[model samples]
Target chain A: MATYLLLSTLTDEGRKTLKARPERLQEVNKEIEAMGGRVVSQYAVLGLYDFVNVVEAPSNEVIARISVELGSRGTVQITTLPAMSVETFVNAIKGGR
Target chain B: MGFYVVLTKLNSDGVRAIHANPDLVSAVAADIQAMDGKVLEQWAVLGKYDFCALVEAPNDAAIHRMAVEQESRGRARFTVLPAMDMALYVRLMGQSTETTGPHPWQIRWPVQIARRALRNYWIDQHVRAACQPLTVLGRENLDGLARPAIFIANHSSHLDSLVLHSVLPAAHRRFLTFGSAADRFYIKGRKGMTKQGWWNSLAMATFPIRRGAGRATLAHAEWLIDKRWNVAIFPEGTRSTTGKMSTFKAGVAILALAKGVPVVPVFLEGLREIRPKGTRDVAPGPVTALIGAPIRFAPATSVSDATYAMYQAMEALRLRLRAQRRPDGPEEAT
Candidate 1:
């Protein structure tokens, strides 16, 4: 299966938020799970961004939908990318394409 | 339970024969199972060995015995690896790597004077100065103790050790040694400051314990205690990642009982806020430490009974520390 990288950032509203509020992030995780995506890791940082999440999804469109749902929550901004494995890179190089 | 990774190499003839003989494969598996180990995985890989197997057994000796049995079967030479879990691996990584220079506490004769001054200035200007509201309780409990004792405290924050060490009187501090993990802190080739921190700890009489090798490490600890220096140990073995108490390892009780030393119970509050587990960042906050009366082990008490008594004493001390609350008050050293 193709792996899509899903990255999400907390919105200003979420940045000022306390962890005691579970509903906001819980809703986002549920949407990603429903789309057959898995969160590989998540980190709370002390910089320009509040939190960073690394997720694996089946396809770009699935990741886009997940990001849209997260953005609509008004608590985070999202970025998604199609991630390629080293095996795929090796195969492409050997394929002469 | 012990986790063992078994590496085996088969002669080309034996490999060909095993491929042709299902009975041979079953026989090998049966022999391993007979040694009281459960095979978790068997993998054929492109390496020197024909196959690798992961097994769980009662202990290291059982795993070693199984490896010997497998090799004697004349199919393959075998080697075993005792697996240290990932959590332990990460902790060891943190402890072994020295990211900075020799700590201010570890310096030569001439530089030692400057190091001590710098340490005092840093503690006074940074730690003590930054935190406006700090309180110390239970000082009398420590001063009242007349005999050599073991101070056991909950492992909450990294600052827990520093706070305890700082607040202790010079005489007591001279006699007291803190216990740290040997695999991490005391190892050579670590980074500068990390090495320094470990050196400082050693200067303060901190001894190192090798984790996971419980029985062997505990015996070493008993020997250290018998040397008659007052020692401080966080019985939980490791810092509590969560803000709750963890199960204390039996090493402390084993050492205390063998040496017949009194165990002094201590509790530190607000240290988690100052320096949370798994982080290098420090937060300014009010912190308090409470030292409870030392509990003596009865001469006739068995090791198990003394262990139970020690646990009870520590629990009671924790309760007292948690109960004390001063919303608006001056910081007092107890």
Candidate 2:
């Protein structure tokens, strides 16, 4: 499986939703797992993003699909980035893959 | 019961201790349970925070006490936020917000008689039961105090008003009126009264006070003062969640100044642990009501000055009581 980084920010409506139902944050993680993605790490942060999530998924398409499904709720906007290990990047450069 | 989100961050020492013995992490839940709180869900997540716990506690004071005890060991820092279910939050928002009050009939002779009977038999018993071994200090301050005085106290719990009423000298209790939150207690109706509002006014001699309504809201209070009714108000306006005195609102000052009445400052101790705001259950505990000497301003005292003076009076009482409670010295580990 490939690793991906997900950064999320909540809209005003999303804040209301979260304020009323904080458990929804964990529920969304369950949703991700149901879609064939495993949440490796998640943190409620205090900076530019409301949450920082690291997920392992089968492929880019799967992660993209999960992001789209969650963003459609209008409460949260998600940005996803595919991540590669430093060892793999160094190997690819050496082998000229 | 109140739901709380307790976000705990372990310090370096805490991290080392937990790393040495991971089972120590369960101590968080145990600490909460020790405080009569239930931990519903907790996660040791990887992030800026070490752990997040959803707990149910009787009130803010209980949860705060638990947090203080836990953090005093210098292992964890906690941030607690009160939570409500989504449905309950929406329903509370949908409640009527219009200010409708100052029911005139509440002061009628018949209604006053009924209020006295209710206070004597029902309300008094409940307060006495919940506030066992209640102590009233400096009540002689009210012995010969004039009628139409304003009794101002530091607000810490929902029990403040009830405790104030229960311990008051009978002479001052009669013809006493208090201000209740308009949005919380009253609903706008065609006749300016709802069932709950009617009962509150008749049973407690309460008139609605619209928050931030300014001098206009004090019209009814002024009328009460003219009728020689004593007014009891928590100048803090709202109950303190942290057992600290919030800034005193100027309403009490305004009323006392306009009516040319003295303001008696009463300091309430130990009520926050009994049944603070947002708690349904009452735990019987000892409570002390320390009444300060009446604060009478010279003629034409400015509103700001009057408010500050009144606040200082209550603050003095609080400090004096705290010093008395711990005669040696204040505890270093808060």
How does each model score on TM-score? 0.53, 0.61
Give the 10-residue window scoring lowest on summed lDDT in candidate 2 chain B. B85-94
Q: Rate the local accuracy (lDDT) of all candidates.
A: 0.62, 0.78
lDDT of 2 by residue, B196-279 (tens): 787789888889888887999889899999988999988878777667676677898888887889999999888888887767
Per-candidate fnat, comma-separated = 0.00, 0.00
Q: Write the per-residue lDDT of candidate 2 for residues A35-86, one digit (tens) a residue.
A: 9999976655544566656688999899999999999999999878665543
Q: Write the per-residue lDDT of candidate 1 for residues A1-97, one digit (tens) a residue.
A: 4554333456668654433343345455666788788875444433333444556777667777777877886777765555444334334444643
Q: Give the distance in Å from residue B294's predicted Cα in candidate 1 to where it truly belongs.
A: 0.3
**Docking quality (DockQ) for each candidate:** 0.02, 0.04
Model 1's lDDT to the true fold?
0.62
Among all windows of 10 consecutive residues in model 1 chain A, the one with the lowest summed lDDT is A43-52
Q: For the second chain of model 1, what is the TM-score against the true structure's chain B?
A: 0.61
| CAPRI rating of model 2 | incorrect
lDDT tens digits, residue span B1-334, model 1: 5556555678766676665653465466677788877776554433344555556676678877887776766767775656544334334434433232223233234443543555555344555743546677777877766446788887777667667767666666545667776765667665586355455553444556777767666553565456555778898788765555655777777777768788887777777767776567877888777777778776777767776776677777666665565556433222
With a 3 Å backbone cut-off (N, CA, C), the pairs that clash in candidate 1 are B98-B190, B98-B191, B100-B192, B100-B193, B101-B192, B101-B193, B103-B196, B136-B334, B139-B334
